[model samples]
Target: MAHTVTDRKKLLNRVKRIKGQSIALENTLENEPDCMAVLQQVAAIKGAVNGLMKEVLEGHLREHLGAEDLSKDQRLEEVEQVISILKSYLK
Candidate 1:
């Protein structure tokens, strides 16, 4: 979406941070860190990913479903797409 272009940099930064956390988790695993340390790393990665997903989902809702220029059919299609994705993501 064109609106996403404006957010591309911010999104990329989040992705980069997630990548760093993943690398740290990998290193922690390799070094035989304590169970709690590994668990904390895993939780940090999950939280970062969830935050990214939340941001992207909010953007999609605002840009696709809340746009005023879209037709009724278009809005319905977007809603269905969102529902399908949510189903898959939640599962």
Candidate 2:
């Protein structure tokens, strides 16, 4: 929750931008229906989503993986979990 509070505006902004891009893509599809334009919009939306993923992942790393009081084994477990998530996400 601390990370969410600290990055509230940032996260909101990213979501808002993604929303805007989605709407724009929808409008373009309805109005122009150009393949290249649609491709560009899709790419932009994917990039925005990836960026948001990165920010959240970093926050998780800072808040959980970087915790100072966790035992070494616990930290390693958390790291492995994070890695598993990343692998699944990238696929």
Candidate 3:
């Protein structure tokens, strides 16, 4: 599937932000920052990672699972995968 340049750029931007967040987290640990502040940063990083995953998953569903020629079994498998992903994230 062909992704627009804009979409690619957006994903790259998100990844870069996540990388920066990771570096900050490392620095915070090295500097012995406040525990609560570090925890909050970690939570924000997790949320950003999850948001990025959701965007990719939604794109996959729209491009592959939504294909008109997909068989019932294929669609069901995709749905199951998505459900499993959600369950794993919840845990």
Candidate 4:
């Protein structure tokens, strides 16, 4: 969220592009008869989503958990939260 204040426009643009890709995937699923075409669209959408996730997660780490000026206690708490998130996400 800290990075979002500065990077809102860029982040929103990425989300919009991902949304467009998802819509295209839906359309292809409904109209395209070819199995390969649907699979390609699905792959593209998945990649876009993964890219967005990577960007946001890195920004969060840099902005919050990785901030050098924070007290050790605060940093440890934030690190635990990030670790919890990763644990669930990877599961």
Q: Which candidate is the best by lDDT?
A: 2
> Which digits, one per residue and each the tens of the lDDT, describe model 4 over residues 6-83?
888888998998889888878877784589888887888788877877888889998887788999999989989888
What is the C-alpha local distance difference test score of each model? 0.92, 0.94, 0.86, 0.84
Candidate 2: misplaced stretches above 4 Å?
Answer: none
Select the stronger candidate by TM-score from 1 and 3.
Answer: 1
Candidate 3 lDDT: 0.86
Candidate 2 per-residue C-alpha lDDT over 1-91 given as tens digits, one digit per residue, 9 for 90 to 100: 5897899999999999999999999999889599999999999999999999999999989998888999999999999999999899989
Off by over 4 Å in 4: none
Model 2's C-alpha root-mean-square deviation from the true structure amounts to: 1.5
Q: Over all chains combined, what TM-score does candidate 1 have? A: 0.94
Instruction: Candidate 3: give the clashing pairs.
Output: none
Instruction: List TM-score per model, in order.
Output: 0.94, 0.86, 0.81, 0.84
Rank list by lDDT: 2, 1, 3, 4
For candidate 3, write residues 1-91 as lDDT tens digits.
Answer: 4443448988888999899999989999999699997998899899889989888877878887888998999999989988898899889
Error of 4 at 35 (Å): 1.7
